[model samples]
Target: MSEGFGAKVPADVERPDRVLAGLTARQVAILAATAATVYGQWWVIGRVVPLIVFAVLAGPLVVAGIALAVGRRDGVAVFDLARAALAFRMRARRLHTRPPGTGPAAPGWARERAHYSRYPCGRTGQLRLPPHAITDTPHHPAPLACLDLGTSGVAVIAAASTVNFSMRTDTEQYALIGCFARLLHAQTGPVQILIRTHQIDLRPALAELADSLGRLPHPTLRAAATAHHRWLSELATDTTLLTHQVLLVLREPTHLHTTQPGFTGAVGSGRRVAAVTRLAQRLDDARRTLAGAEITLTPLSPEQAHAVLATCADPTRDPTHGWTHSWEHTP
Candidate 1:
């Protein structure tokens, strides 16, 4: 007899090496169980008579199970993949086509409406909405009416730098907390503390370094400077450098009445001066208290205050830095 016809087939033919090459033994077992359950159910139902027909019906389930198992091995969950697919589809369908009657180059309002309608939550049309001037919200509070002692009340803005409480001993931390509480208690009116943390901009520092490097004479120094610049450029792209700003808002009570008997009429400059003087006194007291607690407090000028407010309201803009001008009156 010929060896191919009569001899037992090789073991490799019975259990092929390529059958489930990438899958672990456990994954292979699970897949086998899934296929068996699907086919066994079909057989019990007496609906699928042929193996080919059963495979046609059950192929999708097997493929899906295998895909899920492979994704799990690669540290990707099925839900995450589904969400990413959905997001991609949504993004892909976000474009808009102009209406038939509209010209090739539509008006600005029509373009905006078309853009808005592409999303489910978008408003209908620009014509139905209020004018931009009226609808636009102010990014920052309106410049204080009076610039100094507005109608609301006399207010002051000061930035303070605090010590690292976390690094201190428990006793020091408790003492600091107690002192801060006393400081708050000492305030006669409302006090608000606003803490702002922003990514530090390294452009100015890099520029300075570049200028210094240009001044150097040696080639070795220049090569080192180039390497340093490259490292700093990479570092600047990371969101690692952060700066914290603490703003203190103190509002002083307004005195509408003056001691003078004739003050019953319109308030005079003297009364305004007195109110301003009281505000100044309160600010001085606050500065002293904070200083005693080992905190450095610097008052913000009107321009600096405006910049700070704008920076906060819209984070896309850069804030004015190193403002040295002091407000002579009210800011």
Candidate 2:
């Protein structure tokens, strides 16, 4: 008996003792508690139930206990799992119901009829209304009316050319700064300056260059022109050129009285025209002020103003595709 016990087992041999193993200690306790609860219910009832009836009553509890105890190895205790499941179920139920006072105001009968029309199964139907249908409320503001010089009452936009600030001497830069200061100091209303930098598209420039190359008279020069055009084509693909635009926004005086009260009791067209004229004069003054500092300012046309707004609204869009000219300079 001692020799048989001491003998070593081969590595490939199966271990018969490990087969038919029972549940872990925690799983056994959970299953015992579930069984006791079920048995207690049956005893209280004082009846012998069918197997199917017993399974229907107690199957879920047994499955839940076993799953909580042994299904996962993520180190979460059984009670935490049960709490998480309860919370998840509560959230699902809340999401299925409509919040109070969100949908259209209607009588209970109308709402019930509409619901039955959409879902004929009454309360048992699984059809669900989209959240947007219940929650969406749209309110659109009135479109802005433009006055002379494309001026809106809130702001005036002016296109300005950029000077090489980095290359200017100290004295020149100081003069430029002084000029800007005076420009702002002259404004009785608010002033806002917006600077936009965008990638320049070179397709038109390339086309123009190609057209110029076709007109070269001398053979050697024509050959050289062809080579240069090829180089430009390659360069266009390899590099991106960028341009800057400056916008000068001047505010209109909101306190100015109208000649006649309009339907909205706001500023009348005559008053708006007068206000725009004043704003345009101020912009011209600014233009002259910047001109002394070697910067040029041009007023944007209605179409140009729309393009500028579109580019500003979405910076990633191609700035030059729609507009005939670049925003950085006048055509």
Candidate 3:
């Protein structure tokens, strides 16, 4: 792991068998170095206590007391504060969870005798000690695959693809229709097709406009309402109105570009802001490409959308048919 957020995600969660099998050579070296340092410190403190006392016999005992308290209490407090800070920053971030039902080992696992064993050489009387390997030879079983082990058991989300029936050539469409019919006829799985219709709400805008008119003189308000109604009536009858059908293709992970324009240059900076900016630019480019193909692209903002659609029934402009309309709404 290359520092930064790498420490947040444990490579092996309590599954010591995986820890043994999966650790890199460098990681093993670091683990050994850390263990050696801790044990070496303990050994020095144990055997050299008398010598240290003799060397610092006149040294103030007060400083030693403060050092001990800081090492034990303040050091622990600092460690805990660092942990809390990391946790707070991580809560909103999306993390890949480990396979279900894995947790860290119990306390003092490395200190346990089961974690290490001494071996005797066959050729000589020399003794060699090794860290106990977490193997499935006799003690452990195959770890469980990561799955959602909720009360509802494991669940997986899959999205079904949508089909366009109106765009293809007649011959190709007919062939596809026949193939789909045959497939549906022969299929055995329980399949469901859902169709959802979203309707635009213009009541809020209408009410706002009405309230503005209500604050005017009674006669003026009445006249303005009549004019508005007449204008909408004329537009419905005299203008060609076509439904601007928008098909949003959310490219998802499949169509997204893996490399950004400046990502290579900024990779080492590790700024999430840069990655997000790249994604935004890519999304804008994708939408522009779609719009160039005559697809009406809508934004994800509902308020902005409402403001844009507020003029849907306006007299001078018709958004349907991309400024060219052949069929007008009849009321």
The lDDT values for all models are: 0.59, 0.60, 0.36
Candidate 2, 27-146: lDDT as tens digits: 666667877887887786537777688778777887877776556546565656787988765543322123345445779997688777854432321223211100111121212222
Tens digit of lDDT per residue, candidate 1, span 1-331? 2234334667445432334777655457667777787868687854636868767777888887666545543455453576688777555343233333452666899778876885554332212111000011112232221223333344557788889887887667667777787788887776789999866779988998888997889999999998999799899986577889898877654554433222123655455445445555666677787776689877665565656655665566666552222222222
Residue 140, candidate 1: Cα error in Å is 26
Q: Name the weakest run of 10 consecutive residues (lDDT summed) in model 3.
A: 129-138
Q: Rank the candidates by TM-score, best first.
A: 2, 1, 3
Give stretches of model 3 more than 4 Å off.
1-196, 212-274, 302-331
* Candidate 3 lDDT tens digits, 134-158: 1111111221111111111211111
Which regions of candidate 2 are displaced past 4 Å?
Answer: 1-154, 165-170, 253-267, 320-331
Clash count for each candidate, listed in order shown:
0, 0, 1
lDDT of 1 at 217: 96
lDDT of 1 at 200: 76
Q: Runs in model 1 with CA error above 4 Å?
A: 1-149, 214-226, 238-241, 253-273, 320-331
TM-score of 3: 0.22
Winner on TM-score (2 vs 3) = 2
| Residue pairs whose backbone atoms clash in candidate 3 | 99-146
Best by lDDT: 2
